[model samples]
Target: MSFLRQRKTTSQIPLYTGLQIQTSSSAVPIQIVYGANKIAPNVIWTGGFSYTTEKTKAGKGGGSISGYDYRCGFALGLCEGPINAVGGVWSGQSITYLWNLGLGLFYGSMPQTPWGYLTASFPGQDLAYGGLAYVATASFDLGSSPSLPSLSFDVHGLLVGTGLINSWDANPALVIQDLLTNPQYGVGFPAASIDSTTLLGGSGGSSYQAYCTAAHLALSPVLANQEAASSILSRWLQLTNTAAVWSGGKLKFITYGDAPLTQSGVSFIPNVTPIYDLADDDFVISDDADPVEVVRSDPFTAKNWVTLETLDRNNWYDATPVQVWDQNAIELYGLHMDSSITAHEICEPSIGRISAQLLLQRSLYVRNTYQFKLGFEYCLLEPMDLVAISDVGLGMNKFPVRIVSIEEDGSGILSLTAEDFTGGAATAAAYPVQAGSNTALDHGVSPSPVNQVIIFEPPPDLTNGVAEVWIAISGGLAPIYKLADGTTGES
Candidate 1:
């Protein structure tokens, strides 16, 4: 009854149908997936539905007793192809073993070998759903039921090209490109849609890997029916704290900052100067008043403790809690709270804790929001770019702020909203130690290695019965056996 033990609900109990896969509909949206995910295929092809019955009495009784079985062949459409492979196929909450399925179900794409059921049913007719990942089975048993069971799979949908193939699924920057360029069920954009300097193409270098060298920043997400494309893309932007916008008539990904897992340095490092410095002269005077409006959030808006929720790869990708406490915030504000972050794509606990701490720091430290108007001279200015604001009327020196939004009216008045972003506040945080798993679950004990083994004949006084030899062993016990011959004749 301890919480350390795995919890099972009624739905998790194994049944003839097995664990359920992602739902499939007659008109289901094919997912543009990366990495492994549980999914159910849309049954595109079905044929050779037959019922088989056999008589069984006793083993040799030869009496008439009826046992019924329903069987069929099917082709299941999964996702975009050519994926790496299909595995972890499951039925009814358990791994699929030697179910009453026919031998050698095929897992592949394009010019796929047609099922014999199809070939036999439709002579010389073959329509292989090219570029579409799917699975085909010749014969599947359904006990007495005619419909298929609750099938599922841990499908590994890898893009195969540019020599990177399976390796790049973890990198969201690289993976996003594939998702955009895919002609089927994707935006089908050309590679030119992305500017060479786009952060996804490594705003700092040619590869995001060269920019952010951390495993946690790499994302594993399945783009499916649940979310719109914009919403799905927002998840990546929020998780990485990066942004994507159109400037210069091209899509540009902007990584103004990052909290990398393995790296130790400033949250972000941007080249100064060309950062679009704005002086009072550049500000558009409004209502015969100051050109900027600043709103400072009170300390009540801050929290000292934050908990991040994410999936744990080691624990079957189930939800796990990663808590972080900001000591400085506690001293200034008060105690703990969370629910600000739900990064299901983050699979590493350390990264989750780091992100939670980053949120805490930002909440407690980032206190001001600025709004002002500039002329069209800054029309080329885009979001995610750090800018400098100076207003002598407000008695403020050159202050740095990151552009959060930009808008232009018919009057060509460019409206901008910026937030205080100090690189010093982005420094890595060291929260107190996180709680570890319960020690009560560490009950498994392994036997130690054998220390010695001796075999010698015993004296007649020491032995009650005659014996050829007395063999003594240490360290562990085993059922008595004749290991020299690999036989158990001498028990």
Candidate 2:
């Protein structure tokens, strides 16, 4: 077998590098060395080789050769072979001894027949139970050859077909967590994680023209569909809980809308047949969380209801039954859709241009950590670098520490940065940051960074009182800020 190592074989043989394997007589040992190619810095294991031995038997009429003869062979490396062609690197790590790299390919497999791919690897690897072997293997057909692949493809295609792809960027994510946690990956847009960016024409440019044009061309139809659905939600919200009688019990809600409340409304309103069927009107639950026990009111006063205000009547329609237990807590029961709700049930609507107030309580927000000054007056913000900051509850901590960072990138794109003062991972919370210049908190991501720099690559050309920062921390700890000397009315 060693002979093959010395005298290489033909170019047709496939040899794996970056690994060393010793075969018992039947095959020769191989040594893989990386960093041999200068032109291709990522190229690993050049001049690597493999060998094999063959046993030959003598014919019955053999004279001099009565026994079997053995032969060994080897192969040489080509500068353009697959091994030396594919490039990759583990930044900062120099001598990387790769144990196994299951044929370098997408979705973990080697390309077979250019369109199809195959790969072998052990996923549930364990040494005690002989885990150092190929455990779970996966292969995929990339191209449309077999006609029908699977449901995942169709579902993915449908989602991509929708403008939902614009929800994220195409910057190749390194891992699932990167796709989930990285804010830049999704431009801080809600549902952008599960969404795709490639569908956005590959150029997620930070320009009013770019996004506006893209929105005009791409999101219009999607938004139209969304508007239609939102209209339906608004209509549904206008419909009373007459479907069922209202009673004190475990409410059963069903979302007839395509999307859930998280998308455009709050929570999905189960198809609740209020025990006492009353002609449904725009009922507002004082408590957004647990609407039960909380009083429900008409969104439009009887005076306004008579006029039948023709609002968007499609996208912003929302109503729910809420009971406030305290200034910070509430119990929500019944929910209704509004014209503002989107088609996607889980996708939070873009609170792009709505006004807001500390609904439950009214107190001034005074920052404690640092203060800053913009002009002519004692800077309210300490470091001028900080534009606006929010004090949010970061679960397990006493008070909500400042988080998200907002910055103007001079290019019209808004960039936001979040910090983890809780000593947890910076990714403990996931929310959108692709907030436009609208002061309204509607379209922005919920449970977002309370205090972080939001840099607009290009300064937004619009303004409103609601275009403020919002952060949703884990454990439902929504951060709130108050003046340092402000007294707590109630704990």
Candidate 3:
């Protein structure tokens, strides 16, 4: 384990997928999603990636015509498996298009029908991207804009109850565990390599899954194609202060904090009890370095105010920002501010407010930083494990510390860095009461192709040779009538 100075493995992931850029490349990989995510599909079939421009007469006379209306046609690859369904299609980041407007969705069904655009463009090619969810659009109107708009989708990849846990889709721990262990469309880690006991919140500790559900911090993050697994894992860990280990050839996952004291109220285990009590004699004797160095967090690096921004489920998943501050700390520290963005699918104000409060409190507490070294026998100690330090030189007695970093060297020594910790410091208050507007309606569903048409050319005296057509429909939605011909009609 001396090779523990490992290089980061998740450098490829983007910070937040508030926008998923569409890519067109031969070597680009398709995504394998678990649970739900907002994804930007890869362009797998660009054969129909053409456009149309229309310039119509302004006010029934020629010459001074209206600007051109550009329409684009393309096919996109979403992810593996026959997903539950696809929701709205977002243009760039904000504008969302109705499903029936020239957009077609296939839920990665086996033996998928060849896409209409594909079948029409290349008559003999029957490449259906079988067993892969995708979207095909025959025409997307740009309405006086020449450039094609960027596109993304809201997709629910897998939501079946496969006995992993009750409502696994809503439990991030269960969802992540399933993703890593499932042989299909997952990283496919071997069963034996996983330590399921701890990951499922077993033993004396509370489950991470329960905390997420109670905190309203469940995730709907996009795991786009070509993104490394380590990136996704790292993101989840950072969001919840979680840690994953591969000790003894068995992988395990642990969330740093204990379970919420109250499922819905503002409560969290910021720091656990110390696992080991260490003295100067327990540290590895070094000729060139000090074994223990007491540390107080750098005040210059401290923050009294924290703002958290993430999706607000109560507001149609709109981006919401919430700020919390330590009034006394601001008076003492002059208002140092810090901001963070998370991808969790939050639904309550208390969730965001409580999380921000935690950050602010931790900043105000200014946890200690302790640097030390220990022999290989102490290699089992992982980051986040609380330790009690008793030092004669500093006259410190059982001082609590939280490990934040660990590095191993060739000399079979563990280099560690820790900060002062108290479980109470990071526990703050929040209310489940919502503080936002009502949510927008869900996206429109794709309607069937409008095939029943009745054309009437009236007589000369009948309405002055104008053909007036009227139809009645019932229990129906606004028709999704964007067709391949680039013409639109309403009933």
- Order by lDDT, highest first: 3, 1, 2
**Between prediction 1 and prediction 2, which has the larger lDDT?**
1
Please give, for residues 176-197, the per-residue lDDT of candidate 3 as tens digits.
7867887666787787888776
Worst 10 residues of 3 by lDDT: 12-21
The TM-score, computed over Cα atoms with residue i paired to residue i, of candidate 3 is 0.63
Query: Which wins on TM-score, candidate 1 or candidate 2?
Result: 1
Q: Cα miss at 352, model 2 (Å)?
A: 13
- Could you give candidate 1's per-residue lDDT for residues 1-491 as a string of tens digits? 78899877533212222312244466667766576555666776666667756555656656553555667766777777767766566677555532334424444566566555566776665565666777766667777666677766556675421112123235667667767776655676777867656544322342343333332355556666756667777777666545688877788776544333333221223343337778888999788767788988878667777777776644445578887776776777677575667777555565566556656667667778899999988888888777888887776677888888999999999999988887646434544434344223445865555757898999877887677688998775444666666866422
- Candidate 1 regions with alpha-carbon error over 4 angstroms: 1-24, 50-66, 96-113, 120-126, 143-147, 160-169, 189-191, 202-215, 258-274, 303-309, 321-361, 392-395, 409-411, 424-491
lDDT of each: 0.63, 0.22, 0.64
Residue 341: error of model 3 in Å? Answer: 4.1
CA shift at 419, candidate 1, in angstroms?
Answer: 0.7
Clashing pairs in 3: 367-420, 368-419, 368-420
Model 2 residue 46 distance off true place after TM-score fit, in angstroms: 14
TM-score of each: 0.69, 0.16, 0.63
Q: Residue 135 deviation, candidate 2, in Å?
A: 19
Model 2 segments more than 4 A misplaced: 1-158, 161-491
Model 3, position 260, has a per-residue lDDT of 48
Q: Which of the two, 1 or 3, has more TM-score?
A: 1
lDDT score, residue 263, model 2? 21
